[model samples]
Target: MSELRDTELSAKVKGIEVTVTFPLAHGKPFHAKQAPETTVGTVRSEAMSQFGIQEEANSTYYLTHGGSRVDDGATLASIAGESEAVKFTLVKELVQG
Candidate 1:
């Protein structure tokens, strides 16, 4: 059987949209059914790995889904209040290759 993953997801909290992205190996597709129920931090770590981001940069990521948006600096309470885990399509600068 093939492995499953949750590559992307979105949540709407307080009328805002929050998008999440997870990393998959180059040329290896995600198995949607097997993805974990992750949090905002999880998404960021995935992006960091995919982009070769060093820990010192402390870069912020932007998330968008439907009509809502969230930044990496957003508080967990804020995100939890407005979003839910749902399948989404991920598009990241580093994942382009």
Candidate 2:
């Protein structure tokens, strides 16, 4: 008396390597494996967790690669392409009232 469900997809997601760097003293960059469809915000959250950074409502962060800003909504695959590892800098944005 068991029911069966179909779970199959034609397309598969690939894992991408990413490294995040922080500007704080003694801050070291860390590497993480993520799917190509993963968003920048997800990566930022991981970094924050790894670094033990407390989340602030008024403060914000930005991810940059090669001196270019990466949008939070952008996917890792779109930014890294076929590279072995994508380098990203986590910069804290100054909030103005």
Candidate 3:
């Protein structure tokens, strides 16, 4: 039952201030406070717990941004830039073995 600290984010969507909450797999929600420097892999790791996914589950997931797949080494800032909010979709990678 780990609790994530609440973070307030300010973003302007279409000239309106909006607050967005990012939901994790574990029912815990978080904001993109450190998203500018955070990598997709880091976010994925944090979300694994929410989905009851084990690190060694022999599965892989991808975080897609702006209709494109983000690389593990890419930072959120690189994808969203200074946008008020960014949408990320968690997709399970299909195993091809």
Q: CA lDDT of each candidate? A: 0.39, 0.74, 0.52
Model 3: per-residue Cα lDDT over 1-97, one tens digit each: 0111111211222221112223444454433454455566877666555556665455567777655777878655555544645666666665656
The candidate scoring highest on TM-score is: 2
For all predicted structures, in order, the TM-scores are 0.31, 0.77, 0.59
Cα deviation at 10, candidate 3, in Å, is 14
Pick by lDDT: which candidate is best? 2
User: What global local distance difference test value does model 1 have?
Assistant: 0.39
Q: Is candidate 2 or candidate 3 better by lDDT?
A: 2
Report the error of model 2 at residue 54, Å: 2.3
RMSD of each: 12.0, 8.0, 9.8
How many clashing residue pairs appear in each of the predictions shown? Answer: 6, 0, 2
Candidate 1 lDDT by residue in tens digits, 1-97: 1112122222322222333444533443222221233444555555555555445433334444443654544444334432343333343433232
**Candidate 3 clashes between residue pairs 3 or more apart in a chain or in different chains:** 25-50, 26-50
